[model samples]
Target: MGGLIFWKLRGSDEKPVASVQPPPPATTPQVFEQPPPPPPPPPPPEEDAGKKPAGKVVGVGGGGCAGECKGTAGATLQSALAAKAGAARGCYERGLRQNATLQGKLVISVRVGPGGQVCSAGVASNALGDPGVASCVVGLFRSASFPAPEGGCVDTQVPMNFVPKGGGK
Candidate 1:
């Protein structure tokens, strides 16, 4: 049986050779010109930093001044805060996951340096009763940029009223 199987497998006694022969060298040197690459794609559209947040974020006026601490314009602070409304809403929304009905007033105290940098920021007062939301909102303010305060450092309080979508304020 072994001899019969070997005979059947070795039926083709001729050895098979596989080889690829390279093309003969060209008589004249060839010069090929490659086409120029396509122009770089246009930059993506920038997000609207001023876009209003989905949640209700009513602006309140309370830019009181203290000794040596100048008070910035409410409109200026409001514009800066409006730019960050979406992020603030994000913080509120994150807390909403924990408490679906999390909504209240938040007074964020921010100190802006003469160079328009946030020197310090914190939750001056939070009625939301959610520490996570308060911390998140404060964090957003910490990295927020604003117009340079005239004269010296300016301390401002931004009062924001938060109400969930479709909910009464």
Candidate 2:
């Protein structure tokens, strides 16, 4: 009875269908180069139109270190961040691919351990509006190594400004 049921289910002359498979992906990836950005537009004609611009007084101000660091620690930390600026810019450029007018300031708070290793880092303030970009920049700072501080752990703020090409926004 089981054999008869199997024969009936197998059907009297139906052909078995073959399954189709998709082709494999390419071994090498393709890369496309981006064109250079255009030059900035000329500045608007003198607003005052023949009147000498009034001179303004500028004042310089700064406060003491925010952490136990002293001496050239701040400068050293800034220099280290500058070294990674290009990478951070790359992150912003990736975001610009999504939003052409994306532009803002990201204040990164970084804490460096005694061995010149980054203990913790995060975006203290992110006006860029792109969480992915902010996270990428923070990851870069977190993996970076700054100059050891004179005292113990050093905490500092690194401000990075991202402006799209041609200064859109």
Candidate 3:
């Protein structure tokens, strides 16, 4: 009766189809991964870590021209002026030709923009006794380039001394 039932199900006298096979076992052994070790603890703060807070000024002396300038801005301006020293000297010499007695200091106040550009410059003090020389010095400073300062702008003064080529009155 079982054979008759099988024949009825297949409805043919052909050999029965091979049974479906299960997938082969994995050749490599499975790995049980361990979670990564906890991250290292943060380093301890230094003794002088909080000496100067991120945004506060500690002391007020170490800066440009009586603490008027700060950071690399002062150095940047100094170097820029130093680079153009020849031009400034030329201006002074020209003024000397006009008046052989031209000898003194010219203090220039400069305003530097945030993008390392000279916004404006003017003669703060002029002991040279010549407006032409003062104006020329101010123009030279205005054309100078400095490194961008951290703050919005930098206001600083530079003094240039002019001495007569020949020591005379």
Candidate 4:
């Protein structure tokens, strides 16, 4: 099955299971007076495959939009969730305008303990370019929490898109 990994791998040295594939050399060298150059050679196997592909990382900082994360309970908790959504939108929009190649959505599930503490957090949905920004967001929500609404448990899902506003750079 296809699974997502939201890991804090910044500066994490890559441990190649196999040899790294080198990119194909450009066949078309634009030399004036020279005939049109040939097409570039095919890239080597997995030349462009790896963690954190060429894409912008859109960070999200809220939970609540679909109410599928934190359990639903009271007005304060609901309001906090709404606030979280707005924050996520801001972060996404900022990333989009930066000419970054964003093309995915990430949903972060924040778990609030009985005492209204952020006890745990995980990625709910990682797709498109979603997983790219998960690590950064982990720290953003580490200190966040919403009181358990009085009704049932509350689990909020805050999703952010990584698709750049324009195509890509």
Tell me which of candidates 1 and 2 scores higher on lDDT.
1
lDDT of 1: 0.73
TM-score of 1: 0.56
Please identify model 3 stretches exceeding 4 Å from their true place: 1-74, 166-169
Most accurate candidate by TM-score: 1
Score residue 101 of candidate 1 by CA lDDT.
79
Residue-wise lDDT of candidate 3 within 1-169, one digit each (tens)? 9998998988876787999999998799888999999999776676356543321232322332223444345566568756665478888888988998789888888766555666568888888899998888778877777776665457767777789766734
- The list of candidate 2 runs beyond 4 A from truth reads 1-74
lDDT (Cα, 0-100) at 58 in candidate 2: 12
**lDDT digits (tens) for residues 1-169 of candidate 2:** 9999999988867887898888897688767888889999876668543232121101111212223544335567667777786679999989989988889998888766555667578889999889999999988987777776545556778888888777744
Tens digit per residue, CA lDDT, model 4, 23-99: 99879977778788899999765755531222211112243222344445467866775566556654566545653
| Model 2 TM-score (2 dp) | 0.55
Q: Quote each prediction's TM-score.
A: 0.56, 0.55, 0.52, 0.43
Q: What C-alpha lDDT values do all the predictions have?
A: 0.73, 0.71, 0.70, 0.56
Question: How many clashes does each candidate structure show, in the order listed?
Answer: 0, 0, 0, 13
**lDDT at position 62, candidate 3:** 30
Displacement of the residue 58 alpha carbon in candidate 2, Å: 47
Q: How far in Å is the alpha carbon of 35 misplaced in model 2? A: 51
Flag the better candidate by TM-score, 2 or 3.
2
**Candidate 3 TM-score, true structure as reference:** 0.52
